[model samples]
Target: MPHCLYLKHLDIVPGDRANPCKGLMKPITIVYSSKKGYPLVHPCTKCGHLSRNKVAMDCTQED
Candidate 1:
């Protein structure tokens, strides 16, 4: 029910485009990790495939 993004390709394995699930990745929650920082948890609406990805970092902005 949350906001989702319609990606042209799925990156479940990070750059792996062979995945057949072309579902919209819905952002469900924000997860915190000591090593990975605050990465977002996105699950596919169609296949329910989930992935954790780091937020885009701005070069001019401090992390």
Candidate 2:
């Protein structure tokens, strides 16, 4: 089954734009399926932006 997830923390404070003082925050999309071998990837859903760095955009593990 293909599961679709919508990111909670996207675009710095849940908006399309970002704050200059806070910096730009982006959305991260993760896919986990045995058929695809849990391909860990991040693609901005808020604005269709792509980033090569996964760790930088990880908001779930943040303190």
Candidate 3:
């Protein structure tokens, strides 16, 4: 079974907490790869933001 990562409550308010609105709204989830058997390669806060996993320079050069 593939594990799923849940992301929620990602709202940033420029001002005070009172009357704050949800900004940049998004519900994010990550799934593990079946063949590679690797976890999501990135830094994700409990808030649900997924970091961009850039291909390594050396690996790309091989192709």
Candidate 4:
């Protein structure tokens, strides 16, 4: 499963062209999952755009 926490700038594509600040997925520490086990609400901290797709896992964690 993709973790919709923090992602790199090169990993994801821009969701909206109207957003002036284009960057990585800056998770706002908020996460919401749907009943079907899918991420429904994942907002970006840079542009505040809500991403409702599969996201990559956080890179800051050590496996």
Candidate 5:
């Protein structure tokens, strides 16, 4: 599994019609770990948007 600080572009919101920023992949920065031991958070490089990943398998860092 990749570390929390890996670089990734994930969907800001999976399925939210009200989300203004939709259908866009934003770069993520794993700021820190969560107490639940499953919550992963990061910010988008393009829009400074914050995103979370529950599953480590869903996290990816690419060059």
Candidate 6:
């Protein structure tokens, strides 16, 4: 998933791309939660915006 579609940026906020920081988000780590299951933590390569998204059912830890 694209971070611009999910991450909360500076003033632009989440689920929006109105901001000028069109940075590519890279997955940094994965965390397991009892409620949310496994979510991957991603941070923008340009502006450093961070976001966590639930991994797809078919996705593996190596991804």
lDDT for each candidate structure: 0.70, 0.41, 0.34, 0.51, 0.50, 0.68
Candidate that beats the other on TM-score, 4 or 5, i.e. the better one = 5
lDDT of 1 by residue, 30-51 (tens): 8999999998887778887778
lDDT of 4 by residue, 1-63 (tens): 443455543324554454445566654433456643445354565666666655445454442
Runs in model 3 lying further than 4 Å from the true structure: 1-43, 59-63
Clashing pairs in 3: none
My TM-score estimates for the predictions, one after another, are 0.70, 0.25, 0.19, 0.34, 0.36, 0.60
Give the candidate number with the greatest TM-score: 1
1-63: candidate 5 lDDT, tens digit per residue = 434343345443564445443333343434445564555565655566676755556545554
Residue 1, candidate 4: alpha-carbon lDDT: 42
Clash counts per candidate, in order, are: 0, 0, 0, 0, 0, 0
Clash count for candidate 1 is 0
On a 0 to 1 TM-score scale, where does candidate 1 land against the true structure?
0.70
lDDT of 1: 0.70
- Weakest ten-residue segment in model 1 by summed lDDT: 1-10
- TM-score of decoy 2: 0.25
Query: What would the per-residue lDDT of candidate 6 be over residues 13-63, giving only the tens digit for each residue?
Result: 655667787767677788999999989898888888778877667543421
After superposition, the stretches of candidate 5 with alpha carbons farther than 4 Å from their true spots are: 1-12, 15-37, 57-63
Error of 3 at 47 (Å): 2.2
The superposed Cα distance between candidate 6 and the true structure at residue 59, in angstroms, equals: 8.3
Q: Candidate 4 regions off by >4 Å? A: 1-4, 8-20, 27-36, 55-63
Model 2: residues with Cα > 4 Å off, grouped in runs = 1-40, 54-62
Clashing pairs in 6: none
